[model samples]
Target chain A: MNESDLPSFLLDGEEIPFTPGQTVIQAALTAGHYIPHLCYHPEFVPHGSCKVCTVKANGRPAAACTLPAQAGLAVESDTDELNDLRRTLVQMLFAEGNHFCPSCEKSGNCMLQALGYDLGVMTAGFRHFFPDRPVDASHPDILLDFNRCIFCKLCVRASEEVDGKGVFSLTGRGIMRHLIVSAESGRLADTDIALTDKALEVCPVGVILRKHVGFAVPIGRRRYDERPISAQALDDAPRMMEPKHG
Target chain B: MAEGRIRVATASLAGCFGCHMSLLDIDERLFELLEKIEFDRTPLTDIKHCGPCDIGIIEGGCCNAENVEVLREFRRNCKILVALGACAVTGGLPAQRNHLDLGACLSEVYLTEPGLVNGQIPNDPELPLPLDQVHPLHEVVKVDYFVPGCPPSADAIWKILADLVAGRTPRLGHGQIQYD
Candidate 1:
């Protein structure tokens, strides 16, 4: 059924064509309501762990990632509850991973760090999990420290999708479910991967690492770990490559 | 206190120039240190056969006969030997290939008929022959201090240099110190 031909609903006050089964958040986004997300990539089925993109759908809190677009559905994306959830999620990510923002090469510019500050998550109440992960500095140009993993399966997906190499695989169970090598040994650097693994670029946290470049850029010019308006928005930006006239 | 005119040497073996590039991340700070310390041998400064020095910084992991010789020479000359990066400390990325069979690796990198190379690796006398396995610096000789990280963070390099300049013992001997 043509969405333009169907009855439209006011999503964030934007007249969006009503779909039969989609949720308010999804319909709102199809109507151009942008929400920042980490664990929600358009290409893959979302993990929905990082709740940076949670929006108020008809006054009810819901993950915009998994929510489908539906008719006559209202979305309160700018509400307090959605903002609070986003903040909390960003804070959880920072304390969960081995994110030493001051020293990280990706510091001043990490998506998680930027989102946390954007959501005003300054005073954290969660206990920091200071796990000791053995640094897999085995590859000549890459590194992996599991303690820093945020369970964003970007690397796993990247290895399989773009690289066409199933170098990474998520294993274990529950919170223990994290990325490991695809091979039986589950060793990262020893898994015959390359320096520019898609896993390296897909990482939102400093878990999967690379060699050669650190502290090279001056501290003054590095990406600040605050106010993730641009980075997060770009992730969900409408594909320019798609045919708008189609 | 004189802080003692500290001497330092830098060398690489069985690895790419990534580690060296990391050391250069110190930028002008490295040249700034030259005013205080004495430089003995480094790929950047002195290229001829290396001479004895006080603090020897090995950048890469050991993978050949020459690597062994270099490690020994540094151990013999420098009063304090520092493993300045992950490669030197816990075997970094080079050691990953250690998991592979020697013959397989050799064939893949060199002697394979369908290899990328049009010819076999040259049997030239000057080339430092590749070894069967790559080992960390500590495996070959006793290292006095260790600075971990793919390539030791510039802050780490600065801290160690500052410690030595202040006549205090550089604290890289125990526990892992990763600057992110």
Candidate 2:
């Protein structure tokens, strides 16, 4: 089929041209439209664990990051219903973990925090779970604050797929599922994980942080500090890049 | 109506009064604000108890019995109560102690810290007892509105107040609303 005959989908009333295998998120991003997402990094395979990118496709709720964009598909994102659902999902993430944003080093730069702001999640709507998670500062250069993990698994994917070092993995299921270091000693230092690894930069929250560099960028000048996540998403989207063919 | 101005009361509970500072950050706008509203039971007025007021803006979480009492009193006296910052809205920095044992926390602060000469956890009857967990103001009393920030920006506070003074519900949008 010719490139002109490629499938195009309507995302919130805008025509987004997509390759046969491109997901709604990929097409939307490529088309300069921003869909709020956490676990759908472009470099890694879409892991729809966080459900922040849920959109209504043909009147059915679907994960935009994982859903294939088909011709004539009507994907509704940024609606009141989808935003409310996204807010609830953000609230659930907040309640599930001890996401103390004010004290966190990753406060302004965190995608989760920025997304929460974007979705108008003003409060933790659910009761605080206040889970007793451990902070693994065992690594000499990295501080693994488990209390803020959203379980997006970007670090896991980046470590295993990109870095060629299977350093991180998620253990357990459902509410109990958590990120675990793949080392006999169960510490990041024991693993081949380095500060320069893609895994360190892949975390969307304050979970995997480099030690001694807390609050390096200051408050008002950090990423997402100047603009909302929606704007940031569009600005950060790859420019003029052709859609990847399967 | 006989009342010419909106009666406003504000208080700080377990907060650092940064929200009040942010309110002050309204700057020269306060002169304009005074034309529309009047301070009642606020730290600005040094009033101990709030009289019946048009709005009550509380700026911290309920970390002690006094905070709860003040929050409840604010609910009773004010027509509308607003949670004015992250603390009042979500327990903020004070709530960090929620993860640690309260006794251990107090002990660490008092007895176990380095360079402490004579350290004893104060148990004065006059002192308000800290709750086992720090709670957002809404957990204790109904909050009519919320202005969320570490301390909400001066623009945000001004917007909320200006909206309230104009008899409209305040809504924060992109630039106005910030979580950090």
Candidate 3:
């Protein structure tokens, strides 16, 4: 079978070729199509919790990251209606957390902040929850600012799968849900997690931060600030090179 | 004084007047803007009250009763109200206090400080009572447009005003639409 014979899906009217097991987002990324997403890192199994990548597939809302692409599936994305939904979700995320972009150390590189800019979120749109979450600086190398967490759970999965350490986990339910360190002392220092753990790098927001190296990159020159997340997504996309049939 | 110049008024409530300073950062372009608009109750004019105006630019969150009163008055007087900065748009830095108990905050600042000998929370009839949470301008009154930045860049403010003066809807592009 030739690469041209691979199953293809319609993404905003463009044909995106996909391997049998590839998700819509993976296929789209492989085809150089950028889909807005969080909590859908290619390195990990798609959690589909963020829902920023919600797109219409066959007239039904689906998380593009988790939805497996099938031939002839018409996906509607980059449309006014879908983008408006994404904008509202991003705004709710902003309001749910105490995201003060101006003062935050992760201002430029933050995915939530970048998504806010990409989605044209002018205001939080909803009344700010202003939850009083404490900053955990118990670890000498890491700083956990709970106020900026968006419940993406990337850190949780990264710690568990990549680092082979279940140092992070979520507790509670719905509005009260929280990320907790796996330690009796309830502190990052008490856990066996090291500074080299992949979990520290997986957080999309400022919740997990490397101490002393913050603000090292100037505001205008940081990852998302240099190029909007849309462009950055394409730049960082994993290529699915044409598979040759033996 | 011009026959058809747009009447423009600005206010700084629970704000650092950084947005006004950014407006002044328009530098020599101020002359060009002045040709098409007249100040009514801005820091530039030092006028105590807002009058009927074509546009009202507010820069700050409503943190107290006086802020709410002033904002309502501005909304009543101006046909178009612009929320000009992060504070006006999203309650900004002042909204940080929303998580803390207001009474505890008052006590911490006044009565419990180490240097204070006999300090008490100032309770005067003239001082406006503070609200529990600082609210964005739109929460209190309808806002026609928003220029969202810490103190939106001078160019951003200029573009909005120029667009308005030219009968165009103000639009801030990607680089101009900054939160910081």
Candidate 4:
């Protein structure tokens, strides 16, 4: 097929050119358009778990991370209805977890919090669930504060696919579902996980943090502090290919 | 009900009073605010109870029975209620205790801690009994507006107050809305 004959899709009225098999989010990101996402990382297979990137493709709601960008498809993402849905998802994440952002080391750099700000999620809509989850400080170099996990699976994919070390996996189902270590002892320290592992850098929330580096970057000088998530998503999208740790 | 001025009442229940401090951060602009809004029931005025008012600003989560009662009273007395910080909006730091057993929490604080010379969980009827879990303001009553921050910035509070005083619905924009 000719270059001009290549398939394209309309995302919020902008023409997004897509090669065959490219998801809506992939095409949008390449085009400098950001569809808010948590689970979908470019380096790994698209995981549609976190549906914060849900958009209306042909007036039907679909997760942009997994949805294929079809020719002439009208995708509505920035609409009030879609934004409200995203806000509800973000709110659910907040309510389900003990996300004490003010105390979290990843406060300013957290993608979940940044997305919440991007979507204008002012309140945790539902009543706080306050699940009793344990923090794993067993690892000498890493601190796994399970209270802040949003179940995005970015770390799971990064560990499995990129780091070549299956250190993490999601266990259980529904509200009881949570991240579990792959080691027999069920501890991150038991696994061959290192400080330079891609898993450590892929966590969108404050769940997987490096020890001895809490609040190293001050509040005002943090990544998402200076600019909103929307701008950073586009500008920093390509930088995902660069090795984060090492 | 004052004819010319907007009546504002403020309270801090299970919070650190940081939001009130942030409100005070308006500094010289507070004098400008005083010209438009009058204090009704607030810590600033040392008022005991919230009177009938145009706006009520709550700065803490409902962690105790007294907090709930004060929140309910505010809802009954005020025309519009605003959750003025992370605590009021999302239960904040006080809500961190929601995951642990209430009894265990009390024991940890009173019985187990080494610092206490005479460690005992108080059973006095005079003390306000804490709820099983900390609850955000909306969990107890309808919150018309939410100013989200650890303790929303002085400018954010000022904007909300100024907008309300000017007969505008409170809306945070750009730098005004921050989670931390």
Candidate 5:
């Protein structure tokens, strides 16, 4: 079939063409439209956990990442109502964790930080939960600051599918839900996972960080600082997912 | 809706006074700002107590008894209250201690450090008692606006002030609104 003949859907009044079986987020991104997301990485299967990518599909709320793109479907993202909801989600994530961006190693490069900026989140809308979580610096090559996890499960999916290590998992339920390593000792060093594992790079927040290279990029010169996340949203997924040895 | 100069007051509760430094970073612009607004009880004026003011710009989170008292007073006295910077907006760095037990934290710092000889938690009557959890200014009192950088860029602070002076709702642009 001709590319022009491909079925298209309306996203915020712009017609976005999609191949068969493509999700709304994928189709929108392919057409250079940005949908704010954290859990729906292109390389990994859509987890639909983070509702940051929520869009109104025919007046009903749905996760764009998981929703299949149907022809003539009216999807409402980029609206004030949706953006405001996204901002609230980002704020809740900030309040739920110890996300002190200034002190975090992932300050500029973090997706959550960039989304917060894109959505114009000025404050943590809810009271800070200030949960007491563990930090695992046992791994020789990586550090896991569990306090910053938003429980997106990108790492969990990446480890299980791509790395074949099953190195990460989520345990508990509701507010009690948290990320855990697969080792009996509950430490990254105890797992067979390596620095090169996709799991190490999939964290959207500062939860997983490579040691000795924290602030290599200066504040103003870092990713999302140079350009707002909206301008670079489509490229960010693959760019971030691609492994860099250095 | 005053006829003349808008009165502005500023206070630093548990902050490092960096936000005030950023405000002063307005530098020569301060002269221009002074034409439209008059200082009420800021450190620049060295006034100890706040009077009824048009704008109260507060820096820092509520980390002690005095901070809460001062924040409530600012809310009571000022028509508009601006939470200025990460400390005032999100309890900033000092709030990193929110996870730790307050007693243990004080003990670890004052009683159990390696190099300390007779370090004791200061108990002077002049010192304000520390609250168990550091709270953002909004948690203590209603805040009208928030300029939420670590210390919002001098330009950001100036823009907010200028907008308020011109009777406009301050809307920070993409690059202007940052948390860190």
Candidate 6:
């Protein structure tokens, strides 16, 4: 149907004309609602992981990242069920690995840290499993501790897609599964897999880092304090903090 | 043994001196630490490879046959063996080529060229044979305390060591990046 022949209706009791091929969250984003999320960068294809941005659409919790927008659909993007689901997901992430935020350099500025706070993940409901892990700090300018990784796969996808390096890959299985730096050495410096700014920028957490920059910007003026990494739907709006996180 | 001095044996299997360098980064506090730590066999102090100790600190990853032998000896002797640095921690940078065929790496980087090393690989009687893959110390021996940092920051190493001296289990990431 042509633009003139499209259906015009009320979305959340507000008058709006629907656009084609956008998700309910995307339309909501366009309509100025900042739904919280991680693992859903605008440039990449939808992954729908890190269920932090779940929202109730038509009375059921739906992942805002992958759900498609329909004509005049009522999406309860801010319902209690979705909040509960997000809280549960965050709690699970807390239980999975060694995420000790207080000692972490990214304490005040981490996105995962912020989401855990937003979801009220005070304690991990499940038993904590402190897996033995080796951190790769061989690279002159990057450090990696897989123990701190949440398996968001953003670095793996970014390195493969945006940077064309495909340097990072996830390996192993079950609780033993981990992100391997090259073959399985877990050393980033040894591999010919070069680093790019793209992979450095998209890492939701601090698994990857630019050396010599920790605590460089001080506490009060840190990125998380300035913006609080919740749902960023600013529509190509430039986030002005330091972006090297891969 | 006056009271509660933990006997820690420090040894290197197949890595550079960097891991030891990280340990020394603990600095002047070593004097205060000497009151608590009892070192029986260490590369810096003791020359003998064999030792009777409580906690064994093994630097370097196992690469050559000599390294493997040294690691096995330490694993056999010590009550708790701690893998230090990237080398011992996860095979470090040396294992980067485990993904590649040894023949291909040998020919590409060393041989198949007009340099001194040609298509034929080196055949030395003294040199130990290289393994098809590099493996972390944990893959071979059970590790009690896992300190995952390249060469862990001085504070990290200190915290773990201090906790050990205090008879408490050393833990990392108080909940920083942790999530399920």
Among these predictions, the greatest DockQ belongs to 4
Model 4: docking quality category: medium
Can you tell me the CAPRI class of model 2?
Answer: medium
Error of 1 at B52 (Å): 61
lDDT of 4 at A49: 88
Off by over 4 Å in 1: A1-9, A16-32, A220-227, A230-232, A239-246, B1-180
Model 6: per-residue lDDT, tens digit, B1-180? 456777888887766767678788899878777898888678767757757677888877777777788778888888877776656655655665555676787777667666653356767898788876666676666766555444555666677778777878775433222221
Fnat: each model in turn: 0.05, 0.51, 0.42, 0.70, 0.65, 0.00
Q: What tens digits encode model 5's per-residue C-alpha lDDT throughout A1-246? A: 555788999998989888878888888887778999988888878899889999999999999999999999999999999998999999899999988877888887888988988887888868888889979999998999998999999999999888998999999999999989899999899989888989988888898899999878877678888898888786654432112221
Worst 10 residues of 6 chain A by lDDT: A237-246
Candidate 2 per-residue lDDT over residues B55-135, each given as its tens digit: 999998999999999989999999999999988888888888888899999999999999998999999999999998998
The lDDT leader among the candidates is 3
lDDT of 3 by residue, B19-59 (tens): 99999999999999999999999999999999999999999
What candidate 3 gets wrong by more than 4 Å, as runs, is A242-246
- Could you give candidate 1's per-residue lDDT for residues A4-118 as a string of tens digits? 6876666567776645544444444455656667766555556666667777777777777777666666766766767777777765665455455444566555667555545
TM-scores of the candidates in the order shown: 0.51, 0.94, 0.96, 0.95, 0.95, 0.52
User: Please, what are the lDDT tens digits per residue for candidate 2 over residues A100-133?
Assistant: 7788899889998888778777787666777788
Of candidate 2 chain B, the 10-residue stretch with the lowest lDDT total is B171-180
Query: Candidate 2, overall lDDT?
Result: 0.87
TM-score of chain B of each: 0.83, 0.96, 0.98, 0.96, 0.96, 0.84
Better of 2 and 6 by TM-score: 2
Query: Model 2, A92: alpha-carbon shift in Å?
Result: 1.8
Error in Å for residue A90 of model 2: 1.2
Docking outcome class, model 5: medium
Candidate 3 scores an iRMS of 1.3
Q: Quick one: best TM-score, which candidate?
A: 3
Winner on TM-score (3 vs 5): 3
lDDT of each: 0.65, 0.87, 0.89, 0.88, 0.88, 0.66
| TM-score order of candidates, top first | 3, 5, 4, 2, 6, 1
Q: Judged by DockQ cut-offs, is candidate 1 incorrect, acceptable, medium or high?
A: incorrect
lDDT of 3 by residue, A85-155 (tens): 99999989988888888888898888888888788777876777888998999999899999999888899
Candidate 2 TM-score for chain A = 0.95
